[model samples]
Target chain A: MIEKIDGFAYILGDDINTDDIVPSHTLTMRDVDEMAKCTLEFIDPTFAKNSAQGNIIIAGDNFGTGSSREEAVYVFKVLGIKAIIAKSFARIYFRNLINLGIPGIIVSWNESIFSKGDNLEISLNEGVITNKTKGVKIEFEKLPNFLTKILEEGGILNQLKKTLKG
Target chain B: MGYTIAEKILINHSNLKSISPGQFIDCNIDLIMVHEQLGGRIHKEYEKLEIDYVWDPNKIFFILDHWVPAPTISAAQMHQDCRKFAEKYKFIHNFGYQLDKGICHQVLPEMGFSRPGMLIVGSDSHTTTYGAFNCLATGIGATDVSVVFATGKLWFRVPESFQIIMSGKFNKGVMSKDFILTLIGNISTKGAIYKSLEFHGQGAKNLSIDGRMTISNMVVEAGAKFGIFQPDNKLETWLVNRTKEPYKLVTPDNDANYENTLEYNLSEITPVVAKPSNPGNIAGIEEVEGIEIDQAFLGSCTNGRMEDLRIAAKILKGNNIDPNTRLIIIPASKEIYMEALREGLMEIFLSAGAVVGNCTCGPCIGGHLGVLGSEEVCISSTNRNFKGRMGDPTSEVYLASPAVVAASALKGRIADPREVL
Candidate 1:
């Protein structure tokens, strides 16, 4: 019963690692709201400042690479990021994001298809994103069947909790 | 078919009768370690299962190293959670802020916890450093760590072995860090994914134990499972002096089969540095000479050994640091710190205007101290020089050996160590 998300895109270049996603220094703050304000503070000082809640982010290959830090994923979730579309992802980062219930899609389209401020609509169930402003549509690899359940339950820990409770 | 030391160990400890290269197997774990930074979440996950006791407390070790002497209230809370878990579960191997407590990787081997041919897993990436003792070690995620904690078995694919042979003496100013950086350049970052790297040759034998640790520590940079050199008399002598535990000497058989073989002439390797954004982007020091540096740091599990300090001392003796630069030195372990103090290495560093700190993984992880400012440049002896790795995302980090970093600290620009030494 989840609604589809529509938003302007924030396009980033390649190799966005965990450090840029969430600086280690700000990790001292346990509050999700405070931490999200500083997310991607290193890469774009105005990222949190300029971003509206529930905005979509699209990036080139090898996004969210480096360190298994979970805070990097949590910060994005707290900031209300609708979905992340990347050409590819580092194995660990991809797993981490999926485990945290953050919608991360892997699209094979050329990065040139999307640009900043393009109005994009993402359908989690359909696994397709349409750049409405550019009249472009891109398909992504569907999440594995088991991972869909994890996302539905709001992450691995929550899924585990449900299983234990039952 | 003869077997390499790694193959022999995997077969011996493995539940499977025979595991060929590229085959997956579920193996028994001898030790699983965690630090405070990641332990809280892992412990929370374990609590959800409502397990009464860990699978085996003796096989598990937790140390409060990162953010130890807790840098913040939240870090202190993380430590408190770790303490509660340790106390409740009777985790016998837990070490707090005692004299023996230091970096987990440094202390694990020192306390006779790791033996040759054993499999070790930890929550930190640099756990692969235990491979210096001929152990199969790698890092895992918090969930994987919790799973290993609940069950002393983890699944892994038996990786194909890469035979790397080296010969000839290392050129002056080129240390083990430079040698490893050159190897990573040749292999690229993902070149050795899911493979075992076995170092063998006259060149490897010539390296000191500390230098061997430096090389083995960064195997993760090349995406290798582990890096191991056969244990020899030097290792035997060092281990005997350090611990009373008996360890079996192991080596690869003469006819052992390898998936690939790579040969390097040590004399041909120059001072190498990994450029920003990727550890695989390597270049010679000469290629990037005169690149200004705001800081030069000599520490990390990779280059913070005693031998690394002695070499830096030899180069920095009777010299002052560049007026524009800040150089920080951190010993790898408390034992190395005590030894360096006895040998007056500290005075040599302090007299040269360098700041020497405790034996912790500081600044190397960008958690504390020496965080670079925007547009700042740093030459470091630590592994992994990815962009924003040191502090500022815009700051540039150049990876080099202790010799290169020490020399650059004096010159205020990236310079070859041989020129100053």
Candidate 2:
């Protein structure tokens, strides 16, 4: 659905869990935008104030490795995250990204590929990630056709709506 | 070629008669279990789809375990919303604080909703606890659960499975919790990412259903999609009185494929604890002994069963917790709580300076009850020890079995269970 996502890389370390993304206590908040303010508060207290729209989050292995809370993914959406490129991801977290129409690209484990604030352009169509700042190009696998179809429909809800209407 | 238990269950649940790992298929779910998030988030997502009614009310388990007794006004509103949804749908298995239900994972199995060869999904990650019954179960997000409600089907990628062969027996004061922690320590948190962990062999067979549930519940910490056990006479006997529904049992066929194989001798395992920040950061009891703790929490879906309470009570009997340390005890369900009361375990706990709370997933998730403050350190029987997991980000949590927690509470430090026992 989203052929390309161009943004600056927001770097995080390995094993960034769901708890880091959305703390459990914050889930009680009524406003989504207000809840997003607590994203990664412990890891980077300024993540809420510093992160801007369309920034790509690049992290090491097992990103989003705790809990099945979809609020973790919803926080990224509310913050306008363009895409997440991690060396790996926990299963439920990755699926939530796909269902919410966010591209979660899995790149090989190479922490040296991008630095903080590096301009990166990910072309989902070509399966290539071009670190425009560093002049490096990396190839990754595209999402399966079925999953891409869900993304194209703007999320699982839209896809489900189509199915139900039919 | 023979099929693994996961493959067998998926094949039986889906239109396909056969499936290989990584092949995605639409599977019919036998049950969908949801908790507070159902009212808090899932209802909004489900409303977006504009479906008038859920596919089948009978197939849903509407539970309000987390934030039960509504810790805050916001949580109370969420409970009200869940009540509205349950009332509208008339869910057959609806439960709330009023009904005196505990955690969703424990209640589902105790209610017999978790049966052999069934495929279950829950909004909570520990839903994998049902796999102790030899069923295929995994956690899903709110959006996915909403879609399943609209149409009782969802997509699943057939996961590659690992065969964990457990041999030998446990030493005194050691538990299934210790063995599971050892496995997670050897294989880091993401070792089983997107894979099924099929547990079997002598050590696994020797475990009681409660012990098996404790093991299966936290396999998600290893990033496993499912933690299924092979059906044995223990599970069969346990299910006979719980469920009258005719059910089939599934076993991994001989010569079934596995992504990898791991063998563990449970007898060699000793009391272990996962230190601050991560469940994979395991240390022997002796390694972290005498490390002072501010609190000792003994509850959660992971280790809140009667078996766990009995273990903790045995250690706490005739002994009081340290003056500096606070101990909080919560059973996983009403049944477990009643059983503990009948056994006088509640009396022992109350006399031991432990604040026995109602059955709720309170402090384990840092939702309420025993939330830790900044600079506070706790020894908890719950699964995760992630930073900020139990309240303030600076608060540190150490994960261990209930026995370890009880000993730590008695000493006001991370003490060895062997000493207390």
Instruction: Specify the CAPRI tier of model 2.
Output: high
Which model scores highest in TM-score?
2
Q: B313, model 1: CA deviation in Å?
A: 0.7
List model 1 lDDT by residue over B1-421, tens digit each.
Answer: 8887678778877866666886656688888988874444577667876768788988888887766567678877777877888888888887854634567888777777767778888877678788788777877667667667767776666778899998887888888888888888898766676678999999888888888888888887776777888887777777776677666777888999899899988888889898886777899888998999999999878888788999899989999999999999988778888888999999999999999877677687676767888989999998867667778778889989999999999999998899988
Off by over 4 Å in 2: A109-111, B97-99
**What digit string (tens of lDDT, one per residue) describes model 2 on residues B1-421?**
9999999999998988778999999999999999998876798899888768889999998888889888899888889888888887777777754648888999899989999999999998889999999999999999999999999999999999999999988887999899899999989999999999999898899998999999999999999999999999999999988999999999999989999999998889999999999999999999999999999999999999988998999999999999999999999999999999999999999999999999999999899999999999999999998999999999999999988999899999999988879
- CAPRI category for model 1: acceptable
Look at candidate 1 and tell me the lDDT of residue B364: 73
- Model 1 DockQ vs. reference: 0.24
Say which candidate scores most in lDDT.
2
lDDT of each: 0.79, 0.91
Candidate 1 lDDT tens digits, A35-79? 889888767878887777327888876676556566777677777
State TM-scores per candidate: 0.85, 0.98
